[model samples]
Target: MFLRTVTTAATLLAMGVTASLAQDPIEERQQIMKDNGQAMRVLVPMARGQADYDAEAALAAFVSIRDDAARFGELFPEGTETGGDTRAKPEIWTDREGFDAAVAAFVEDAEAAVAAAPADLDAFRPVFGAMAENCGDCHEVYQVPEN
Candidate 1:
């Protein structure tokens, strides 16, 4: 009975440790980006005029971006550069200042997009385009191309 209890306790402890380590920085940041993508999807059809414009939805999407932007820097801590199928380019660490600036610019633009939330599909195009431009700029410089 004592041996059985110890075995179960060890198994439970190992599971706890595994769960804690499961979400490393790379996975955490990727999940954040995935969430951002989800928000963008909410705005895509409206921006293209395929769906009726919804100001509340547009603003909420922008807010999601803004919120994620604030946590951008924390997701790229040192030593997390090469692991777990990360697509982060070495340039992110090599040009840390530039990468940080890009993140800051994204945060600023995200906020601007939120504040300039469009009331109509026509108005949303430019605003969404500008925010997307920031994302593209960072990805071009910092993200590794997928094979």
Candidate 2:
């Protein structure tokens, strides 16, 4: 009987841990944005000619952004307009159609960058610049300014 009780307690503890690991939408989206930022860190210096152009690194960054873009819209579910220290503007929920279109444009740009597979600095510049602009435009409309 004692062994069974202990086993049950362990199972309950494991379940609680799993539940805690499940992130709410705000947390999930924040993580996705953070990941995109990391990818940008990899690409931006090369774009600026501050770092050597690396085709492999550039492609990886593009892929990371593309993958994140694919799921980014889904992370902004109906009730996620607030909380979790979100910088998401209410415009995301209020202007859902526009927000979605912006996300679509970003996804398209990311995919194009990956497909273009820029092999040199000259080739990468245009593709990277376009994607960067997309990010800025979306943030202008959809995100609150950081304090």
Q: Give me the candidate number with maximum lDDT.
A: 2
- For candidate 1, write residues 1-147 as lDDT tens digits: 664465456445544643464468787688667767877787778877788887877786787678778877878989989988999999999999999999998998888888887787777888898888989999998998778
| lDDT on C-alpha atoms for all candidate structures | 0.79, 0.83
Per-residue lDDT value at 66 in model 1 = 88
lDDT of 1: 0.79
- After superposition, the stretches of candidate 1 with alpha carbons farther than 4 Å from their true spots are 1-23
Predicted structure 2: clash tally? 0
Could you give me the TM-score of model 1 versus the true structure? Answer: 0.79
Q: Alpha carbon lDDT of residue 125, candidate 2?
A: 94
Lowest summed lDDT window (length 10), candidate 1: 10-19
Colliding residue pairs in candidate 1: none
Highest TM-score against the true fold, candidate? 2
